[model samples]
Target: MTGTETLERPETADKVEHFDVIIVGAGISGIGSAYHLQEQCPDKSFLVLEKFDSFGGTWHMHKYPGVRSDSDLFTFGYRFKPWMSAPIATADEILKYMGEVIDDNDLAPHIRYSHKIEHAAWSSKDKKWTVDVVRLDTGEKRRFTTNFLWMCQGYYNQEQGYTPEWDGMDKYKGQIVHPQTWPEDLDYKGKKVVLIGSGATAATVVPAMADDTEHLTMVQRSPTYFFPGQNANELADLLRAVEVDPMIIHDIVRRVALFQQQEINRRSVEEPEIVKQELLEGVRAFVGPDFDMDKHLTPKYRPWQQRLAFVPDGDLFKCITDGKVSIETDTIECFTETGLKLSSGKEIEADIIITATGFNLSVLGNIPFEVDGKPVNWPETVTYRGMMFTGVPNLLWVFGYFRASWTLRVDLLGDYVCRLLKHMDEMGVKQVTPTIPDSLSDMKVGNWIQEEDFNPNYLVRSMHVMPKAGNHPDWQHTQDYWREKDEIPALDLDTEALVYS
Candidate 1:
């Protein structure tokens, strides 16, 4: 057996282990945390515990056909690693990229895969966290303690998939599938498929399935705003000509892409109607006037209020125009043995049903956590700077925003955490937590975004947190690259908002 396999197949559990910091969830955030931590605190004993056998978190778990990043690779990719391949990367490619990152950084030894964290509790007297974990394969339970606990655990559990309750769903004779936990061996060729919901997943899957499936119908409760993916050939060509180190190329491309995205966002904010018109016109041109654009195309909310679905080269609209795909905007009244029954008294038949209904916003996964033996209610605890939660000592959470690439925000948070850890070490502080000022009220804190059709759990929780702009210019929430570089480095680590002891 390989040395790695030997270690993984341990005969007995190592019940008592210690670390300077314990990071949960080995996804992008967690891996990023490890990368930063290793650089900042080389001497510190740190461990990354992932529930799954492999890395790549979300990218690894989601294996549906046509699964790829909605955001362009340049900005969506890690700051340290440049996206040298396609501007829009596929799931498998992204996963491979993640694996390379882990290998390059020598992060394998730090990670213990299949080690699912069950619970974590803080000991006020010990000034440390006692974390309980389980080995899924062996059903072995063990405990470990750490000076700091970092939750890199992403906001969703792929296993606890979301399935909306539609009447008569149980009666359906055909195979029902949720894209989150898609079946491997299911065949779609020559099958009439009905895809439920109108989100990113649905938008992506419909076009992909259209080529093989006899006919694909998208059932929508409400319409989602659509935007064409701008994988700029000009930018791609420029990067190709001036090919430098992959790392440098990645950084340059990331900056350029960030600028482009910011420009789009700026135009949308300044000229909402014009931006809306352009988007609608683009969709109309692709889908053709034969399709009812007014009924099925328009969204209830303004652009960027919720994420606009990205269709690469109008792939989704192309499929629709070619008669391979169709969209139904009526409310799903119930499910039937043959297909879905709409409130309009129309029944559409399908041999297979795919529920791209949406995801459960696991702001924090169901893993139980306590501070000083008191149960911590996540909703009740205010988020600090939208990254860390107030009242939770020595803990940090990284979450992305609706307006920018998730990795951009996550990179910044990772840097900030590294800086914070360094600052804490210098001051010999054992614990740190945000102190939410009494003056800060819900009235002062406005929602960053709102959409009737989009899921609100994560956004709502994040809105109440102090904005980077209001707190300090460095912590201020501009997604611009130059501004972030200038401000983030200059952030006052000893800000009054943070309590150190």
Candidate 2:
């Protein structure tokens, strides 16, 4: 191990293993990080440790009904890899694609599955990190050391999805389920299904369940915006029809999708009313003018303040329009023996309650971290180029954009990390940190991410525990991908505030 032999990270008698870099979480980010590390620093030996039993983080974990990509596959797929499938692809398809990436790149064996990380401590004297881990199968404790650490654990609590308590939850006789913890043999067929959230999960599940179940009711406290996207990409279709090369088609489609996303965000900011009106018009046309657009469609916040859920061919709206599905936009007073009792004095009968209430936000996978025997305060650490944190040496975390496809930011961070590693090698640096000097310490810093940027309840609830941002370049989180593209790549590593040892 790189650390001193006297200091043992694992309490057990296991000897410590060491590597040049240690990547946490074998999900999308971890896979991408491996790819970049291989390409950028081929000589470096690295290891990937996953807490879960398999790869494909979100796709492997989430099996809720109709779970699919909210963003276009082109944008969601890795930048180097062309998403050749439908614009909006199902979870299985996405998982298969991830499998292809891992297999084609020969990254599978590098991943140690069912290996849960328990603790991390950095040694300043040795410039190495000692990580404690445990294998789920055997209760034996293990230890590993690395010069660099990369956290790919996504920004939400992995253990469970967020579900609020109802007044009479225990009184409910029907089966209660959360999207995150979906059972293998869940039988909603021929049953009345009532979903209790209006986020992406509920929007996705309603139409799928409606097709099979006797009825599906989406009960929401308020409405969220939904936009229509074609199931297939026109360019991909046209290119295939003309017998064009798939590689070229992939590049062109990826570029076009990014441009379109930028344009939509721009228009939302420049003309909020117009975007809102047109979005509502889409719902109106699909559900007919008679549908209660005011109650079931309109949102209190402006467009793009929260991500607009994607529904291909307006399937959800069609379900609502055809009266195959219904919506209740009110608070649930309590759960009854048969269904939910609303505060509006209305009772909705259902056999099953699916709480698609979204995830509880988490930062760095809630892993306990210490540096030189000191507990690192994450909130006080300003974001370094929206990836690394202040006072943390040789560590990087990947958090994607809320307004766009997560892979967009992931791809950027992957490439940036490779570049950073190269720079560090050239400088012969063992450790690097964005340390605040006396002059810049007094400068005001902002929250890591602004609440207004995304008005989602999950984010609002857990943001306080996360890191903060600043108005300055090194500390701010520019959610805009296009702007970040210019700033991140060009960031100078050699700065007075940045310490290299």
Best candidate, lDDT-wise? 2
TM-score of 1: 0.90
Candidate 1 residue spans exceeding 4 A from truth: 1-14, 230-232, 438-488
User: What's the alpha carbon RMSD for model 2?
Assistant: 3.1
lDDT of 2 by residue, 1-501 (tens): 112223334564459889999999888788888988887789888999998889988988988888888988888888788777789989899888888989899988789998888889988899999899988888778899999998898888878999998888999999999999999899988899899999788878888888889988999999999997568888899998898987788889988888988998999989999999988887787888677889988999889999899889888888987777999999989999999999999999989999998889888988778778767778868887778888888999998888888887777887787887888899998898877667677778877777766678887887788788877766777788888877777777777767899
331-440: candidate 1 lDDT, tens digit per residue: 98999999999999999999999988777656566666778757666655555655666678888877665566777766787778778888888998888877755554
RMSD of candidate 1 to the truth, in angstroms, is 6.2
Give per-model TM-scores. 0.90, 0.96
**Root-mean-square deviation of every model:** 6.2, 3.1
Candidate number with greatest TM-score: 2
